[model samples]
Target: MEQTWRWFGEQDPIPLDHVKQTGATGVVTALHHLPAGQVWQPEEIAKRKHVIEEAGLSWSVCESIPTEDSIKRGDANARRAIDTWKDSLANLGRAGVPVVCYNFMPILDWTRTDLMFRLPTTGYALRFDMIDFVAYDVFMLKRNRASQSYDPLLVEKAEQRIAGKSEEQKKLLETNIIAGLPGGASAQTRSSISSLIESFQGIDDETMRGNLFAFLKEIVPVAEEFNVRLAIHPDDPPFPLFGLPRVLSTASDIRRLLAAYESPANGITLCTGSYGSRPDNDLVAITREFAHRVNFAHLRNTTVEPDGSFYEAEHLEGDTDMVTVIELLLREEEEAGRQGRRPRIPMRPDHGHLLAGDIDRQTNPGYSYNGRLKGLAELRGVIRALTRGI
Candidate 1:
């Protein structure tokens, strides 16, 4: 697989030079400054591309062309939003960036209750504790019917967790969960996010699935026209949240989506951390099953509990079978190589633990340099070992 890093352009604390030092030759990013559903003018794409090339790296993937809320909810502006999204894809393709990652979840890109949950040995990792989340949902954000989402016992525990916190701690918890993580796709304050969550009260899982299909039906053809691969990122946590339905969480979900368009341009960004949050999503099997449909990858792991909570783990040491997953990807690449097709998928170290000097420095929540460097080094070792044996 080709190694890449997610770069946040000029403002990133870990600049492109530092990314080059990590042995990543490609970058996965987007015009985060642009609002969702707006056209990505070719000039903007070229400027970002120029910066990456100057740093001796290619912009391998546009980490996203964000889906508009109107499109996801099938509101009146859906057509205009999707048209803008398609326009962005066409311009990206024109700029010679072929792969674009996107997501369809109604609200939030990814949610975690703890940004720096301390570990016994390796420092801190991003975490999602059910109690912490439920406390926010039921007691803090006070989303409608949030209490019903959890079991009666879990709801009680949420109450206890909320009761045990200081006011300052409660505010921090809410901000971490809602203000969005570093480089997150969506962000809002407590009032705005709560209202956004409430807006989807009438939309059920089936309706959400239909909306996703409606989105793919319109955009997939544009992707094909531009020769761009639309790699839809799996819903983080792989489940519903804030009472909103999440469609792209399981293997069957991808299969259904592939069937929706039945084209190579319609692809999956197989994020291990996102799908791996669900214990039932066998990463190896899913990799094999959807080998040809995958256009991008985000290789990371999580230590998930039997309950829905999980925390980011060392790239290889979490709940996922990282070895088998990478082995499968290598096998897929090898097969593609013999067929004269794109041989390797583009991937990055999704998230890394904060270690050593990083524990004290003010770094982007999960984009700490030292930890990701360690992660990329470890992953590169696995790639080399597998190659040597082969």
Candidate 2:
């Protein structure tokens, strides 16, 4: 359990020095200024890594190197784009960055209905209210045949939820739902979102998975050559969104993904919060089953309601049993060491709440320092306790 903090680059309000002060030795960051289809210049990679090293932190993982829309579409331009991506990986590997995390969720990285759900304790947290999402999809954004995606009772409930809102609430929901925040990865104007949905009309889950398999076949060899582990993040919410297909959401999906290529370079990000959104995904079991190929981890929890609504719960407080999960990770690491192939997985606290008067101050929802500091502290304690008698 190497502690790493996600840094968004030089523009991030939480600077590199601030991250070092959090007692994390590793920095998880990206070359965000570079556009999606271009190769990350070696000079640029060196510059960011030098900054982190100067702050007395090791550059441990690449939080992302975004896959362009052309790649996802498998358009003619995608071949050149993936070549650029390969060049970028070579640059990062040459600079000694060991892990790269990326996701294939089409058009958007993650989706949430509300960024500031006022919690019962007066703090604010990011929430995914399924009914509100349904309302937006059905009557607000009004995607074609969006009603088919939700159950009849759920659609009726969404209608009720939206009916009571004033005009202001409706506008805010639309803005938060589609317009996105300042530095967040998604950019979707209403028309753009509509166009994006239209683009996915003929692509089903099978086709999307096939595209991803083709992608890994092209990229994993580069990763292998450079000793960089490319870890694909599971779909956030771990399910379909806006009627678009999600290929990386389940344990079986992970099995299939690894089976696509026999290379260890084709691996997973192993996001517990994403997979744990469904009650059936046992976190301990998942770690044991996929531990060898898990190169990165987003350790967090979610509290799911019956209707598919969920909210980010405190790191050690939700449905995921942190104690058991930590123990299992340690056990797996021990087993791997016996085979003389010990791997150190990089993990960070994903999606913390906006607590302690921070919600009104315009921070990235679930990315404020206070909540993540709390989460890291708790997870650190859990790791400490689990490893004490080993």
Candidate 3:
């Protein structure tokens, strides 16, 4: 495993020098300034890569080459997007970046109702409470047929949660949920959000799945030609949000996708935090099953609450079996070595809570330093223990 840290280029509060000091040799980043659907120019890639190299780190993974909305919607612009995506891959290859992480979810990258949910011991952490999310969908965002997304008991809980809110709290929660406060991007206005939610009206789960496959079919070959591995990130909650259908939220989704394309370039960015959100996802088994296809990874853990809420836990203390998962990854690396494959998978401590003195400040949700440094420390110890025993 190649330890990496995500840096948001020049604007990142945590500089590349700080990342290098963390014992990570790779930087996972993207052209955050580029709008979606645009090609990443070669000059931009080279400039970023040069910065990373100058900092004694390699730009190991492009954290994403965002899938265009046209591709997600399967609209007339899909073909153009397929071409543009190929061009981006070529640009990355030209810049010597080999692995790219991306996701195919329709509306949002990831959603959480609470960006600062206080943990029992840790000061505050990112969280997704099912009731809170449903409350936002049913009462706040008011998505169509949002009522149908939850069961009766969940609906009851959601209503209670909504009712419990004060007017100001209600406004804040609505802003937090739909305003995309933590998108690490600008917040969308109420009208824009409404229009965005309305856009998913007819795009059901199956339709989204079809679009994803169409997308893979279109670009996987180009990725293979460029010696780039395109790893699709799993949905953050491993489920739908706001009545939107999430296709890459399960193990079966990855299995079907790999079988569909059967290309070495078609890969998975296996995130323990994302898949571990679902209790049924047996983290170790999924890791072993998809071992051959995972070219990138995000190792973090979460503790799930009964109400479908979950908070970031100490990397090794959450719902994921961190020990077993890492052991499997090491075993997979051994196997890959036997098969003559280089096993340098780029991974980072996915989301770390705000702990220590970070509680008072507003950091990018989940990208805080203190907690993630703690997580990386723990994970490093775990990896060392596993390797020593092995």
Candidate 2, 1-390: lDDT as tens digits: 789999888878788777877778999999888766678998899999989999899999997887876677777887888888888888998899999999888887777878888778687777888899899889888999999998999999999999998999987787766633223425556677788778778888888888889998888988988889989999887888899888998888999999999887888897888898977788888888888888888999988898888888889878888778777777766777778774677889887888776655656667888788888988888888877856
lDDT of 3 by residue, 1-390 (tens): 788898888988888888988898889999988887788898888888888899899989998887777788888888999898889988998778989998887667777777878778847888777887788788877767879978989988889989999988877676566533324335676566768767777998889889889888878888877788889999878887777778887888888889889987889998999999888888888998988888898999988877677877889898889989888887788778888875567779988989887777656678888888888888888888888877
Each prediction's Cα lDDT score? Answer: 0.86, 0.83, 0.83
Residue range 1-390, candidate 1, lDDT tens digits: 889999887888788998999999999889988876679999999999999999899999998887867777888998898889889989999888979998887777888888989998858999999889999989988887788888999999889989999999998888778745333425456777767877777888788889889888888888888878889999987887888888999999999999988988899999999999999989989998998878998889999987689999999898889988888888888888889776478889998889998788877777899888888998889988997775
Q: After superposition, how far is residue 87 of candidate 2 from its true place, in Å?
A: 1.3
Poorly placed runs, candidate 2 (over 4 Å): 179-187
Q: Lowest summed lDDT over 10 consecutive residues: which window, candidate 3?
A: 178-187
Residue 78's C-alpha lDDT in candidate 1? Answer: 84
Q: What is the lDDT of residue 332 in candidate 1?
A: 82
RMSD, each candidate, Å?
1.9, 1.8, 1.7
| Backbone clashes in model 1, listed as residue pairs | none
RMSD of 2: 1.8
Best by lDDT: 1
For each of the candidates, give the backbone clash count.
Answer: 0, 0, 0
